[model samples]
Each structure stands twice: as structure tokens, then as C-alpha cells.
Target chain A: MNWALTLWRLASFAVAAGLIALWQLIANLKLVSPVFLPGPDRAWAALMRGFSNGTLLDKTIGTLEHMFYGWLVASVVGIALGAMIGSSRAMRSYVAPSLEFLRPLPVSAIIPVAIALFGLTQGMALFVIAFGAIWPMLLATVHGFGAVEPRLYEVARSLHMSRLAVIFKIALPSASPDIISGMRLSLTVSLILAVVCEILAGLDGLGHWVLLSARAFRSADLFAGVILLGVIGYVTALAMSMIEQRLLRWRTSGH
Target chain B: MTSIALRKDIPSAELEKSQIAFSHVTLDLGGKTIIENVSLDVKPGEFLCIIGASGCGKTTALRLAAGLYQPTSGHVSFDGEPMRAPRRDVAIVFQDYGKALLPWRTAAGNVALALETIGMPKAQRPARIDELLKKVGLPNHAAKYPAEMSGGMQQRLQIARCLAQEPKALLMDEPFGALDAMTRQGLQDEVLSLLDASKATVIFVTHDLEEAIYLGDRVVGLLPHPGRIGIDLPINLPRPRDQLTTRENPEFLRLRRELFDFIKASEA
Candidate 1:
């Protein structure tokens, strides 16, 4: 079984390598203009040069910092609001309609309004990123806390637990699986929105680097920036899953 | 048997000394009556079993005694005082041990949840948690989560958690009904031993007539469709009941047969 799993993993890598090789062939045959689609070799060289000169490293850090801060802010606000709304029947009834209306409003659509408010600043990017990212976490928390096993509440009641005690000791832990899943989704949203905001606001991040390279007709540089963004997404997702595995160890390790 | 007459025959003086009392308690949910005009009194440290068909409101009756639900009419009380809300002195053990336990927490952590709710000092919790786990025969499995434990082990953990509350009464809703025969018998004896030490009043609800007779000092049967007491029979079996011997005793068998007949007739 272990060997079969290893073979399957190797097959996946082979597929990815095949796709890249196909792209290299297309570029070599000049099916796409060199200005639009650079060969993989040129992209690789650009990536190395950018890193050696430290420009790529600075931009990567900037993007990561922006994404992390927005995600953190969204997490705190989402959990607090979700607990308040989820625990109280009256609160849920009152707030649910408004949330339904606001949740689906696209964050990119509000970018113009945000730019008007914060004007090409990091604050604008943060606002846009947070607004886009908070929904998944908030909804997940509401779902988690709301779906807590009714028996656990009965247990809490029989123990004469205070309202606060129920929330902390029972509700929070009970809702954690949902909350963690929501955070993972929110982190992904934060990254996407962070890039969008940086590009639109002309902030100094990978998104801005890509946008500048495109405008300057530096196709290899643009491809390099896009590749780095993929790396960032991969690394962050890997890190988040590790954290999830640790936090929810009980679920995976037990029945 | 005239159950209502049996209730009436109980002296008012004895009623005052009752640990838990349901006086003409009628509960209605969603405009439908669940249990109507049910009256029963549990003596201090007595193990009372309530048995009935499905949807007969035995669990609902247990909930009223636990103060998780209030009766639509009449009163339910603990120690002569109206049970307005759940009190720290009463703990409940639910039948679905899988749902009853916090899956995220280990056995020790689940026990600690009860202690934490009662506001035990942080510095003193570990010792008490250890004692409670040991009491439930889960001393070595403290670090295991509920999912890691067998059904019997999970039920024992639930019992351990409830014991941590130091409750004077335990309201159980078919707590051992889901376990296999062997595990159920083991837990039945384990609970009896635990009660021997704590002397807590117990209101155990189940549909199993033999189980009722084996574990209860008195077994009360409920008639379905707006449940009401159908029979209230006292078990004269000896204490520290041996699973094989007590079950074999003629008196135990007679009481079990009587309860069985009551349930069958009520269902019909």
C-alpha cells in the first residue's frame, strides 16, 4: 500500500513535468509571441536574477506580511462576531438577513470605494483583503458553534455552568473543527485579495511586480513573479494544514 | 395497578423528605401534551428506574427532574424547593455517550470540563481529575480521546465526568442502553458500586424491563400517548446485587415479569 501511494505521487509529479515540457515546446516553436510567453529557461533565469538581487525576496515578504495581518484581523473579528450571533437565537434572527445580503457582495467590486477612502496606501490593501476574507471564517464559526451537540449543552446545564463557561469550555472546543476549516479558507482568500489589492493599489508586492513587468513588456519577469506567487500559495497552504493537523489531532488520530 | 392511587397513598410527610418530586407535572411541547399529570417522589439515595415504550416521555420526565425542562403545569422540585434551573448539585448522564462527551478533549480533559464549570481552583484540578478518572476505572486512559475508547470506555468516561460535579443526584437517560450485554452488566455493577460510595439519588430511564429490575429500588412504567404512570412496583431484591444471582432470584424474576407485562399491555 505504501509503495502504491509513492507510485501515485510520482505519477502526479510526472504529469506536472509533462505540462511544463509542453509549454516549453510551444514557446520554442514560436506558437505564442516571445513577448507574451517566454520559454521556461528564460523564466527560470529571470527568477534566479530577481532572487540574487534580493528584489523578489522583499516583494515576497511584503505580500506575506499583508496577507498575514489581514487574515489575523479577520480571524479575531469573525470568531467574536460568530460566537455572539451563533449562541444567541435572537441575535441570529436579527442579523442573519443582513449577513446574507453582505456576504455575497464581491470584495473586488468595492476596491474603487476602498481606493477612494484610503488612496493607494497599504491600509487600502488591508481593508480590501480583510473584507474579502472575513466571510468564510465568520460563516464557518457560526456553523460550528450553532451545530454543537445539544447533549453537550444539556451536560453543561446539568453542571450549572454559567453562560460564559458554556461558551468557553463547551461551545468553542465543539466548534473548533469548523472554525479551523474556515480559517484555512479565509487564509486562501486573504492571499488572493492581498494580491488583487496590491496590484490595483500599486503597492510593493509580487502582484505589483507582475503588473509592472507586464506593462514594461518584460515577459520573463512577469512569468517569474507569477511562479513565485504559486510558491507562496503552496508554502502557506502546507503550513496551514500542518497547523490544522496539530490543532485537530484528536479527529485524525482517533475514531 | 392504580398508579395514581399509589401516588396518593404516599404520606405528605414523606413527600416533604423526598429528594426529587414531580407533583402533577404535565409537560407540553409544540401544542401537544408529552407527559400529563405525572407525580412521583424519589427518596434520598434511592435508585428509581423509569421504563416505557418509545416516545412515552420517559426521557422528557427525566429532563424535568434535571431542570433542563420546566413542566407546563404543576411543579418539579429538588429537596422541597422548586427546580427553577439546573443546580450544580445535580448532574446528568446521557445515553448517547458519543455525543455527550467533548470529542476534542481527552478523558481527563472531559472530566476537567465539569470541574472547571463548578469553579474548582486551577491549582487543585489535576488531582481531582485524576481521582475521578480512577473512580471510573479509566486511570490509564486519561490521555485518550473519546473516539479512541471503546463504547464501554466512553460511557465510563461520561460517568467519570458526571461524578466530578460531586452531584447529590444523577439523572440518567438510558445511559447503558447502547452498550453490549457484557459491557452493560459491567457498567451496571460499576454504577452500583459508585453509588454505594456517593449515595446519590438516581433517576435511571430505560426501556429494558430486566435492566430496570436489576438496577432500581423501584421501577415505574409509563403508558404511551401523553405518558402517565401505569405501574409502580418496588423491587425487594437484596443490595450489592450479583449479576447472576440477583437475576436468578425468584423475586427479581417476578418483578421483571410484572414490568414486562405492564409495558406489553401499555403498548397494546
Candidate 2:
């Protein structure tokens, strides 16, 4: 089993390397115009130049701050509201229909409304990002809290736990697995919305960098921004999984 | 007939002395009658076992006593007060130990949940947690998660957590029903010994007739289809019962046979 897992991981790395090589070959053959598609070498050079001159670093930090703030707001509100709605049948019945109507509406469609409300600034981007990211977390929390083992509630009651105590000690911990997965989804949404908002609002982030580079016909710089965004997404996802592993260590350690 | 009349007259005074009492309790769930006009009284420190066929509301009765569920009519009282909600001094040991225990917590952590709920000082929790874990024979296994432990061990940890409540009354709903025979017997003895030290009033519910006879000072059998008591018997077996000798004892055998017949009849 261990050998099989190692083999699969190796195979995944090989596939990625193969794709990169294919991309480079296409560039060398001029299958697409250089203005349209830059080679990996050119993209790498652009990346190095941007980082060395501190341009990419600033943009990266800006994008990260936008994503982080948006995600944090979404998380706090999502979990709190979810706990309230999920733990009570009456609350669920009263609020779930309105949520359902709102949840399926495209988040991108709300960008104009956000822009109107906050005026094409960082606040507009933040609002759009949080709006897009909140759903997954909120729904996940509601589902998780609602699905707690009924026996545990009985145990809680038998122990004479208060409402707050039950929520914190029993419901919160029980719902954490669902909540964490939701946060992961919400985080991905946060990043995507952050970049979209930045691009549309003409803000100082990777999204704006990519947009400006394209307008200036600097294909290499545009490709560099795209590659950096990919890296950021990959790294953040990896970090989330690491945090998940730590928080849910008991689940995997022996069972 | 006169002696039977006298026996009926004795219950009024007995109800006053009882630690836990159910007076004509009826429970209806989702339009179906679950328990119908069931009345019972358990003396302080007495080990009372309730036995019946499946769907006989034995578990419902235990839940009522635990204050997990309220009767649709009549009342359940603990120490002369109406049981409106679960009391800290009444701890329940559920049948599904896996579900009853918090899977994310270590054995010691699960025990600490009870202490924390009751507002025990954080500074004093470790010693109390250690004492409770040790009491349930999980001294070395305190750091183990519930998932890491065996079924028997998890059940023991559940017991340990319940004991941490320092309960005056323990309500068990087929607690050892999921374990292997050997493990079940081991837990039964462990519980008996624990009760010997605590002298807590106990209400044990199970379908196992021999278990009822072996453990209880008295046994009540319930009839199904809107459950009510069928037969009530007092066990005359000696205390500190040995597994082998108690099974061999004539009185134990007789009570076991009586209970077996009662269950068979109730089922029919």
C-alpha cells in the first residue's frame, strides 16, 4: 500500500512535468503567436524581474491581504449564523427558504451592486469577495451542526450542559469536519473573487497586473502574473490541508 | 385477596421513600403510544433492572428517568422533585458508546467535558480527570482517543466520563449490549463494584434476562404495544455475586427462568 501510494505520487509529478514540457514545445514551434503565448523561459524571466524589482512582491501581498480579510469575515459570519440556524428547527424552517433563494444567485452578478454600494474601491472588492465566499461555509456549518449524533445531545443533556456549553463543547467540535471543508471551499472562492474584483476595479493586485500587462502587450509579464496566481492558489490549498490535518489529527492517527 | 390489597396499600408510603418514582406515566411520540400508564418506584441505592422484548419502551422509561424525554402525562420525579430537565447528579450510559463519546477528544478529555460542563475549575480538572479515568481502569489509556481504543475500552471510557459527573443516580440503557460476552461480563462486574463504592441508585435497562437477574436487586418486565409492567420480581441472591457461583445458585436460576418466560410471554 505504501509503495502504491508513492508510485501514484511520482506519477502525478511526472504528469505535471510532461504538461510543462508540452507547453514549452508548443511555444518553440510557434503554434501560437509570441504575443499570445509566451514560452516558460520568458515567463520565468518576467517573474524573476518583477520579484527582484519588488513589483510582484507588492502585488502578491496586496492580493493576499484582500483574500485574507474577505475570507476571515466570511468565516466568522458563516459559522456564527450557521450555528444559530442549524441548532434550531424553527430557525431553519423560517430562514432556510430565503437562504435557498439567495444562495443560487450568481455571486459575479452581485459585483455591480457591491461596486455601487462601496464605489469601485478596496471596500467594494472586499464586499464582493466576502459575498461570494460566505455561502459554502454557512451551508456547510448548518449541515454539520444539524447532523450531530442525536446520542451526543442526549449525553449533553444527561450531563446538564447549558445551551452555550453544548454549542461550544459538543456541537462546534462535531461540526468542525464539515465546517473545515466548507472553509476550504470558501477560501478558494475568496481568492477567485478577490482577483476578479481587483481586475474589474482596477486595483493594485495580481489581477490588475495581469490586465495591465495584457493591455500593454507584454505577454511574458501577463503569463508571469497568471503563473504566480496559480502558485498562490496551490500553496494556500496545501496550507489549508495542513491545518485540517492538524485540527482533525484524532480522526486519522489511529482510525 | 386481602394480602394483595395490603400490598397495594404499602406503595403510597414506599413512593415517599423512593429515590426515583414514575407515577402513571404515559408517553406518546408521533401519534403512537410508547409507554402507557407505567408506574414504578426505586428505593435509594437500589439496583433495579428493567427487562422486556424489543419495542417494549424500556429505553423510553430510562430516558424519562434521565429527563431526556418528558412523559405526555403524569410525572417522573427524582428525590421528590419533578424531573423537568436532566440533572447533573443523574448520568446516563448509552448503548452506543461510540456515539456517546466525543470522538475528537482523548479519554481524559472526554471525562473532562463532564467536569467542564459542571463548571469545575480548570486548574483542578487534571487531578479529577485522572481519578475518574483511573476509577474506570483506563489509567494508562487516558491519552488514547475513542477511535484508538477497542469497543470495550470505549465503553469503559464512556463509563468513566459518566462517573466524573459524580452522579447520585446512574441510568444505563443496554450499555454492554454491543460488547462481546466476555467484555460485557467484565463491564457488568466493573459497574457493580463501582456502584458498591458509590451506592448510587441505578436503573439498568436491557433485553438480557440473565443479566437482569445477575445484576438487579429487583427486576421489572414490561409488556409491549403501549408498554406497561408485566411482572415485577425481587432477586434473593447474595451480594458480591461471583460469576460462576451466582449462575449456579438455585435462586438465581429460578429468577432467570421466570424472567425468560416473562419475556417470551411479553413477546407473544
Candidate 3:
């Protein structure tokens, strides 16, 4: 099984590598302007230069900090509100329509309002990121809590569980899988919003760095910055998956 | 009388206590009647099974006994006190064991939930949990999650969790309905022996007439469309009943035939 999985992974990676190789070949053959698309070597050189100067790392760290703070706040508030709303039909009915209206508005559209309110500060970026991240987490948590088996509640009642105990011990754990999946989505959204906010607000982040490179006609540097963002996104998703696996070890493949 | 005396390990003073009773109980749900003017008396150490068709509301009656539901207008009491809510002294085993046991908890953890409810100290729970698991024939499955176990194993684990309560009354709602025939019979005997040893009052609800006769001290059949009692038959088969002998006994056969006819008529 391990061998088969390894072979499958290798095959999947080969396809991705083939795409990258084709992009590099196209750049080298000058099918696209070097200003529009640099070769892999030029991109690699640009990445190495940024690493040597330490500017890239600083911008990456700044962007990550904004994303993380916003994501954290969103997660805490989303779970609390979701649990409250999910556990009671009246609360859901009262709040659900407004939430639905606000949810469909894209995160980028909120940037102008945030900037008008908070200016080009970190606070503006944070607000945009948080506003974007909250929806998926909140929706997922609501769904998870709602889908809990009725029989489990009956069991909790039969055990004479206090309402608090029932919520904390039974409801929360049962809803965790959906909550984690939501968090994964929100985390990715938070990253996207952080970059967008940084670019729009002119904050010193990876997004700003990419904008600076593009203005100076440094296509290779711009590509390097985009690659770095991709790497960060991939790593964050991977970390979330590992945490989910560790926490939900009891969940079988059959489930 | 002889079997009752033999099963009574308690002091004579506590032997004949009335554990649970339902008096003129009428249950209405969503403005529609589910149970109407039904009465029952569950004596100490008795195994009473309620059997009926799909709409009979036998499970509703069991829920009332477990204090999960309240009668529209009547008394459902435990030890002479009106049952307002579920108490630690009464434990319920739901038919959907898959939903009843926490998927995240191991078998031992599920059993420990009862001990935790009783506020048993952490230090003493392991020994008690081991004993309960052993009683349910799940000594090797303490660390297994409910999803990892077979249907029969999960049901056994559910019973173990109930036993952890040291309950005076056990309410089961078609607990073995999902299992195969052999597994159902095996669990039926296991439950009998455990109840015999603990002397807990049991109210088992099932639609299977043979199961009603095999495990119950008295089998009560409920009629549908308001869910009232249609027949109450005392099962006089001897104690320590075997799958072969007791099922073949004339009394068991008579009750089975009577219940079969009653259920067929009710269904029609």
C-alpha cells in the first residue's frame, strides 16, 4: 500500500513538474516577452537575491502576522456565535437573513470601506482579513452543530447531563470536524484578504513587495513573490490537516 | 415466587420494593396523542418487555419510564417519587447504539460517562469500568471506539455504560433490533444474567414477539393509534432459560402465538 501510494504521488508530482518545465521552456524560447514571463533561472536568481537581503522574509512575516491575528479573532467569534445560533432556532431565525446578505459580498469590496474608516494602517488590513475569514468558519460551525445526531442528545439527557455539560462535552466535539474544515477554508481566505489589503492599503507586506517589483518592471522578482505566497498557502493548509488528523484520531475511514 | 426468592440477594427488608410505576399515563406530542391512559407497575428485579407494531409507541412508554418524556396527564414515578427528569439511578439503552455512544470516546470512556455523572472519583473509575466491561463480554474492547466494533459489540458496550450507573432501573428501547439473529439471542441471554445478578428493574421495548417472550417476566402488548395496552401476559417459563428449551416450552409458544395474532390484527 505504501509503495503504491508513493508511486501515485510521484506520478502526480511529475505532472506538476511537467507544467513548470513547459513554462520555463516557453520563457527560454522567447515565445512570451521576458518582461511578461521570466525563465525559471531568472526567477530562482531573484528569489535568492531577496533571501540574501532579508527584505522578502520581513514582508512575508508581516503578511503572516496580519493574517494570523485576523484569523484568530474570526475563529473565536465565529465558533461562539455559531454555537449560539445553531443550538437555538429562534436565534438562527433572527440573525440568519442579515448574515446571509453580508456573506455574499466579496472581501475585496470591503477594502474601500475599511480604508475609509481606518486609513492605510495595519488595522485596515486586519479588518478586511477578519471580515473575509469569519463567514466560512461561522457557516461550517453552524452546519456541524446542526447535523449532530438527535440520539446523542437523548443519550446526554438520559445520563442526566447538565445543559452546559451537554454542550461542552457532546455538542462541541461532535461539531469539531465541520468546524476544522471551516477553519481551513477561513485560513486560506484570511491569507487572500491579507494580501489584498496590503496591496490596496500600501502596507509593507509581501503583496506590497510584489507591487513594488512590478512597478520597477522586475518580472522575475514579482514571480518569486507570487511563488512565496503559494508556498505559504500550501504550508498553512498542510498544518491545518495535520492538526485535524491528530485531534480526530478516533474518526475511522469508514466514517 | 421461588425464583424471586432465589434471585434476591438483598436483605429481605428491601426485597419487594416497587421500583417504577406508570399510572393512567396519557402522552400527547404535537397536539396528537401518542400514549393514552396506560398503566404499568414494575416490581423490584422484574424483567418486563413491551411489544407492539410500528406505531404502537412502545418506545414512547419506555422513554417515559426513563424520564425522557412526560405523560400528558398522569403519573410516571420511580420508587414512589414522580419522575420529573432523568436521574442517575435510571439508565437508558437506546436502540440506535451507533448514535447513542459518543463516536469520539472509546468504549471505556463511554462507560466512564456514567461514573462521571455519579461523581465517582477518578482514581476508582478504572477498576469499576473494567468490571462493567467484563460483565458485558467486552473486556478486550475497552480501548476500541464504537466505529471499530461490530454491531453486537457496540450494543454490549452500550449495556456496559448503563451498568456503570449501578442503576436501580434499566430502560432499553429495542436494544438488539439492529443486530443479526444469533447476536441478538446472545445479547438477550447476557442481559438476563446481568439483570439477575444486579436485580435491576428492566423495561425492554421490542417489536419482536419471540424476544418479548424469551426475556420478559411479563410481556405487555400495546395497540397502535393512541398506543394503549391491548394484552398483558405473564411469562411463566423457568429461570436460566435456554435458547432451545425455553423457546420450545409450551408457555413460550402460547405467548408467541397470542402476541403474533395481536400484532397482525393491530397492523391490519
Pairs clashing in candidate 1?
Answer: none
Give the top-scoring candidate (TM-score). 2
What is candidate 3's lDDT per residue for A1-255, written digit by digit as tens?
999999999999999999889998999899999998999889989999998999888989988998899999899999999999998899999999999999999877888898899999998888888889999889988998899999988878778888778878888899999999999999999999888888888888899999999999999999999999999999999999999998888895243
**Residue-wise lDDT of candidate 3 within B1-268, one digit each (tens)?**
1122234355666546678889999999999999999988888878899999898899999989988898889989999899999888898998999989999999999998888877899999999999999999999989888989999999999999998888888999999999999999888888887888898988999988899898888999999999999999988888777888888999888888899999999889
> lDDT tens string, model 1, A1-255?
999999999999999999999999999999999999999999999999999999999999999999999999999999999999999999999999999999999887889999999999989888888888899989988999889999888888787788998899889988999998999999999999888988888888999999999999999999999999999889999998999999998898765
Docking quality class, candidate 3: medium
For model 1, how does the per-residue alpha-carbon lDDT over B33-66 read when each residue is reduced to its tens digit? 9999999999887889999999999999998998
- Lowest-sum lDDT 10-residue window in model 1 chain A: A153-162
For model 3, name the residue pairs that clash. none
Docking class of 1: medium
Task: Order the candidates by DockQ, highest first.
Answer: 1, 2, 3
- Model 3 compared with the native: what TM-score? 0.93
Screening candidate 2 with a backbone cut-off below 3 angstroms (N, C-alpha, C), the clashing residue pairs are none
Off by over 4 Å in 1: B1-16
The TM-score of candidate 3's chain A against the true chain A comes to 0.94
Question: Each candidate's DockQ score against the native complex?
Answer: 0.69, 0.67, 0.57
